[model samples]
Target: MQKTHCIIPFEKNRNFTGRESELTQLEEMLFAGDQTTKVAVFGLGGVGKTSLVIELVHRIRKNHENCSVLWIPAINLESLHQAYLDVARQFGIRGWEEDSADVKRLVQEFLSRESAGQWLVVFDNADDINMWVGTPTEQGTKRLIDYFPRSKLGCIVFTTRDRKTAVTLAQKNVVEVREMSEDVATIMLQNCLIDPDLVNNKTDTSSLLKELIYLPLAIVQASAYINANRIPFSDYLSLLADQEEDVIDLLSEEFEDDGRYQNVKNPVATTWLISFEQIRQRDPLAAEYLSFMACIDSKDIPRSLLPRGQSRKKEMEAIGTLDAYSFVTRRLANDALDLHRLVHLSTRNWLNLRNEWDDRANTALHRVEDMFPRPKHENRALWMSYQIHAQCVLTSTKDREKESKEWYSLASRIGECCLSTGKYQESESWIRQTLKLKEEVLGKTHPETLVTMNNLALVLDRQGKYAEAETINRQGLHWL
Candidate 1:
């Protein structure tokens, strides 16, 4: 038996914490059979797919002394080719030294031999499928997948953010790496932080982890910031809570992480920004959905709230693209989609960076307005389900958009809903805003302005401000 030759690029993470179950599952699957096992580990960027794979490969090297291991970063053609060349050099494959020699083919041929011994190969960051399987028009060209060696003694693993790529690579043998559990995330944060005492306050620790969405990379980034600034968990949490911009600024702070790709930015925001750009290039409709979704509340988004696509099929495909990237998840009971909170913030920041925030927000406002039902007695159940989303849309409206007719209409509908539901204070606020706008744009004597005044008076009356309500009614009548 030949000695195991491990070719991992990154050192094993000594600070790696948790993911015991996932490690166990990957171990079992890799060693389950002799007939060339293949598994793909996939999830959102910065969810620790690469870390988990690294851990698994290290375990494999320790447990199987005779098995050779190879790590290839499939980030691009150059990286993959370089990794294959390195493997060729390690194996001392003849002719690989020549520029004309096909290093990939040489490595592939050597691994396919029966005497190559048991081997495990990991393709890290295989997020781009077109590079592996050429696009429709480029089918005649040789693809990266063609160079992958097949052998009964070999096990292959892929880490990716795109579920479609994962499925295409490994079919049913896919493991999704979700955000770490609270307990695991807390432990990881403690491990990452230089000062363990900072996490002594359990409440602050929990709040910090929750705000980071328990994603391993985000937790690590937060810990890095806290460690660098010599701040406590509460202080970092306060900064995160200050405002959306603050949160984005914090997540955008880059730091050195030994376990990650050297060329990649270590910030949580920038890590996911790569995935966002890929989604935009791969599926523009999904990109549009993401932009629009960023302007509204992140949770409990009814499918009906989305703008209509060219067709139902296209709409579902767009949503499926978002789901494939783990950016949005569907609720089992209601089928409503919920975007990850951190992803939501990152997306909004991305839009702002591109100077497209207002356009997307305006689109969201108009979509909500078009779909928002009147506050009629029969529409109560429907509007009730949409109430929070309506409020979110209204809150996201800029001062400039507040003057738009759609804005006034949505505001009035929401206020009417509030009035019908006996939320007198909120109703009065919305109706007052609408009345001010109507009076400015359409004049105080317009029928719509009178209607808004009447609604405001009713809300004031409901709140026991009869004197003010009577005065509003007289003013409306005098204008008429």
Candidate 2:
């Protein structure tokens, strides 16, 4: 499955592949029936998270006709608030204004009642962690979630990219997800093609498909282009292999404009970039957070690792900015905190393409290299904060893909510097992290993605984890 799996009929033709296990898990959690279940399914973008949930919601609606299934993409606090009000409207709450606290109270009251039985609410993409930082939208969806009735009849599901945020909200209920299977990817490609029989050409098609790592998003996009252009599957493969710009161009087609999702562009990458631009315009602090994220770990960004140099007011404002944009999310698990991988990836790619980022990529990398692990015996809280900064810095730029290789060379020099200074762990981590970003944004099939992949993989192999090293080797080969 590629990015094109997001297309409706195209994806449906393949009969909805992957995520069966996740669906079953959700069903069990929602149907267990004793306590009000607060479950969260989280993972990277394009890993079939939303699709699986959509399928689950459809099944629940069809089977349990009495229950009201509400789907809300809490893209931001305002969006989340709107979704809450929409739910209220569903219950025939007339005269309910979106900003009215009275409407919110009523929503809480209704859900609290025993009669609101077997209802399920999905807070999809509620990954923005900024929601909890300050003021915290006391009157809107956050309040709604906090106030939602705790009853066996009520079930709440949140899909997010931030594991920390999900865990914080649902605790042990968080379920992490991954990409689709190879078999499913092949089926999806075949079904999406104009002539499905062409999919059987095991030589070039299979080879190209494997290069995409069988990611649902990439596969779907590739399939749509191949079918739409009436080109041999091998030619499409050759295009992806030809140049970084070509792959980016190929992924940016308008394939998923199937009515309901008119706003979301095709290739998944561009659609995600709009959200990135939104964050930048609506919230500079959040945009900065995203820029910081581009140069970081790209996963496992702990809240405690964030920079608190800002005064409490500034901190709150920054957190609020991110929450309002739905760019950074936190999962509250009694006390634990986590960030989403998808948010990180989207932000990194967004920054990578911005000609402006090239100017600061080196400085950002140096900042991260300077602060990792913190000074002396760090507490878990401080460790988390440092890691988050490190991740943000790592993700903020792509020295490898710049018009000049100076940034990449600078990164290499820094890594070697760290290594010579007996900070081999930091050196290796920085190199590997930078390499991964280059591969994703600069093109895994391009020299930059491939070279960094090789450098990082070899570094990893030297430190053991040969299996991990081998995986990187194969990833680089896809570029070849």
Candidate 3:
């Protein structure tokens, strides 16, 4: 595949992909003669947070022609301060440097002043939490957020991966971004790639593409690679199926013309690495937690189940650190703490490249199992909790095929845990759900599912529910 470097500006005429609702919500927030509202767009990296923000700016500029738009990337405190300086420069604030701090204060005050109607400031990618905790201007990134004066005349929007950051900044005004639907993905692919023919014929190609989870960065990388290589979409699919590492390697290849960004080392990979390395350096425990998380599927992780070495408290702290950096998201029970699949992939890639893949995975597995559900009648709640944790730990792991036995063991153990809890109905329900998913994804006869079925039947038999147990056993017998 040819190296791709320069990121072309998104086509204005092209249909904006996957954010119609978000745009509409933003429009509502900022609609009509300057009612000051702060909105935030936040999600995992590469979910197109920046793209969405850029597009929103264009829309706001075009439709609300009178409104001034100011954008600042808050990756760190200095960049945020520079943004203040830039805002000062834009306003032509003379002698602003005479009293820099006072000038900044005035700028904030002016922006929020009743006269500053129809102006919007977008704080893009404000991921760092320290930015929020300290004094808004003097200590950390928090000051910039605080600096944005609350005025009915002005509006602000922030984009970040950390839910906590969004809460700290915009609170109720935050919007969570999910993966794009097929239609949006198709539109995005069509617009981004060089070859129209391949996109037009994206029947089988689309199916293969879905496995990459429809993340904007992944789609962009895939489209760019396919266009540059002139490879048939089918061949590309074959390479992808053959090895994920191969696809990542191909993505990593750099284009000489584009210098760094255009090279095969995809933007997704590059930016993710920077975040990963930072987490590792600043918070090794969180880094370890993230590395373990990389071993599993990222879409839904249960916090109770994550591998947290010997110190449970320490693990929670580590998770907090990761959460602050927007590396990991805390779903907090309602949906099981979900991690972005792209983050999962990037983390695994980082671990494998650094030669810590096995160590991380094994440590995760060990610590996770240690926290697994224990079996006892009275402590059924505890058992169920542990069961959920173990499932999350196992599910979050990577290379399920290689760890088939471990998967089977974990699944079976969960089933056993459920049975022992005497929540027989709940046990049956849990086993049935696992079996249904396992049957569809892993197959009906996959040892894991079969074992779970047998366990479920055993639970039924133990409860003296012979008819139900017999029915389940009959099905398993056929599989055997």
What local lDDT does model 3 show for residue 240? 64
Q: What are the per-residue Cα lDDT tens digits for candidate 1 across 1-480?
A: 555588988888999998888888888898577678889999989999999998898888889988999999998888987898888888888899996787777888888887888999999999988888875333343567777788899999999999999999998999999988888888898889898877789999889889888998888888888889998887887788778887788888988888898887879887888889889998888999999889888998988888888999989999999999999999989889999999999998899899898888999999999899987898787888788888887888789999899999899999999898888999999999999999999999999999999999999999899999999999999999
- Give lDDT tens digits, candidate 2, residues 1-480: 101001111122224676778878888888576777889887655555666777787777767777777776666666656666777766765457644456656766777667666677777776665563335444344444455557677788888765656776788997777756677788877766788888678787678667665666667777777777889877887776765456566666667522123444556557567556655665566566567655666455654444453566765666655653334556665222233444554555566688656655565665555445423333444443454444445445554543234344445544544544456677787676556556555656777667667766766776786998898898778769
Candidate 2 residue runs with Cα over 4 Å from true position: 1-14, 94-101, 132-134, 137-144, 257-260, 271-349, 364-480
CA shift at 227, candidate 3, in angstroms? Answer: 1.7
Model 3, 1-480: lDDT tens digits are 111111112334353577889778778777444456878888766777777777887787777666777776677767666766777776765566775355557677767665665577877767776665656544423354456677776777888876667878877888877778887888877776677567677676587468667877777777667778888777777766755677666556543222122212445665678668767866787887787667655655666666545687777678777765556556655535656655676788898889887677766667666665546677666555555556655654565433444554555567667576566776676576667667767777878678778877887887799998899989988998
TM-score versus the correct structure, for each prediction: 0.96, 0.60, 0.65
Q: Rank the candidates by TM-score, best first.
A: 1, 3, 2
Which candidate leads in lDDT? 1
lDDT for each of the candidates?
0.88, 0.62, 0.67
Question: How big is the positional error of residue 23 in model 3, measured in Å on the Cα after superposition?
Answer: 0.5
What RMSD, rounded to one decimal, does every model reach?
Answer: 1.8, 13.9, 11.0
User: lDDT rank, highest first?
Assistant: 1, 3, 2
Measured with C-alpha atoms, the lDDT of residue 208 in candidate 2 is 67
